[model samples]
Target: MAQERDVNPWVKMGLELGPVIAFFIGYNRWKDDVFTIAGTDYNGFVLVTAAFIPLMVASTLILWRLSGHLSRMQILTLVLVLVFGGLTVWLNDETFFKMKPTIIYAMFAAILGFGLMRGQSYMAALMGQVMPMQPEGWMILTRRMTWFFAALAVANEAIWRLMSTDAWVNFKTFGLPLALFAFFMLQGGLVRRFGLDNGKG
Candidate 1:
């Protein structure tokens, strides 16, 4: 089990990011073998799908065993995995794996927007364990994240649909984390300006 102190943020990020990496690697390395997993005459998509499912399942299991239960982010992430992951298998399409992040982003955008519309800051609830902040701070941070996630969703769709697969792969592996880290850095500065808990927040 992962305690608060035991969980390295970057390692947490990696565990969460692993499936995407696995999909890219598997799809590229075993493109032919991917479809051949169930039988020799399977669709090319099935090969990738077969590889994608097991990695995602293992990742989720490890996460559950470590986190012990679903956190909001875990719940949100798992829903996308199960849905897109299933689509990958059922439709035998590798594109489903590639485009899964868009769904994840869209779900988050909607959820955060809903929280804002309801006069609550649910994003704050999700992150509160790792970072403590005042109620006012939470509200402000929530508002910031609401748009950030919404914009990310739009960007994800554009990136995957319009861009080449190699470009999308590079973006997923390198681009998204940089964007997230930059956004958080900017958010941290704003939170500091608002005097959120400097030590704990």
Candidate 2:
């Protein structure tokens, strides 16, 4: 893995978010075009879905080349995107793409929930190398994240069902990141209260 100094926060954010932004742009620009793929004419959504898979793969590859390793969460997300995105293009349906977020959030919730049940905190396992914290802190944070992911899954389902495609795309591209930022900020107190003191102190 590359050292923290090697990864610029702004660059990391751009690499992580660029594909979704590309999809949003691609969709809006080609929404009126009917493209033929695999002997089937597809709508703008499918065209965007097709484009998304490659963009995501490319971004992930770039990240790996830069960082020397991909995080577990990143790999899981890429796999889901390819699966759902491929289905969206192959089946000429947007439902698969729409359901991708729900699946991702639900899977995370389930994984964390299962870890909690087994007296394990997967959050610590996932992030402990970077952020040292007390075990109790990990437990609390894990539970909070589990519920938060569940809530996001539900919210994604509701928005996709109740809102237009463009609105859902906006939510995915903008609202989700905002919510995540707020959530992280809200947990600052807990982190401070339960964080472990390294020898550097």
Candidate 3:
């Protein structure tokens, strides 16, 4: 199991996402127990919300301590979570929690749109670590992904506004991940179009 520690990037993502998953489970399982974190019989869900801030703080400190580096995107994401997540746990409401995905997607859309406007393919620069595509290729990819993120943000808003909380929770559990997988499939063609074969290039 020690080899598991080497995958810090994925671990970091799980750490960051853990609280949100907890919130969904918590509010669904025991909404009344949210404010009862002082006792041993803490609700699994409420317990997670209570630990969200400290867990995030510790996770960040640990990640930085171990890696000695943190990406700007990662930092931005963490800050947003702290802000919105704090509101959620403190307010004992899911509105802030519900808005979290929307904010993140909108931020991504903004970044992509800004990059496209400036004639720089933002997505390429951001994703160049895995595949070093030319600037033009990056631009093309960025433009495509910009619209995609915007659409995702719109969809999140629509779902939250129209559906029951339980439905939204279930969607978060299943729908988003499924959609993301499908999206990566669609972007596969772009990887090929850029003359870089994701299969071997």
Best by lDDT: 2
Candidate 1 structure quality by residue, lDDT tens digits, 61-161: 77666666557777766777678768877776657866777778777778878888898889667776667677778888887877787787788778878
* 50-84: candidate 2 lDDT, tens digit per residue: 88899899999988887778878899999999999
In order of appearance, the predictions have TM-scores of 0.78, 0.92, 0.76
lDDT of 2: 0.89
Q: Which 10 consecutive positions of candidate 3 have the poorest summed lDDT?
A: 1-10
Which residue pairs overlap in candidate 1's backbone?
Answer: 34-47, 35-47
lDDT of each: 0.71, 0.89, 0.71
Candidate 3 structure quality by residue, lDDT tens digits, 1-201: 122134366777776566557656666777555344444354344345556667767777777766666667768878886888788666665577678778988999998898778878766666687777656677777877788889889988999999876677778767876787788888766677664554444
Query: Per-residue lDDT for 99 in model 2?
Result: 97
Task: Tell me the spans in candidate 2 whose CA falls farther than 4 Å from its real position.
Answer: 1-5, 36-39, 198-201
Superposition-based RMSD of candidate 1 using all C-alpha atoms, in angstroms: 3.5
Q: Score candidate 1 by lDDT.
A: 0.71
Candidate 1 lDDT for residue 152: 76
TM-score of 1: 0.78
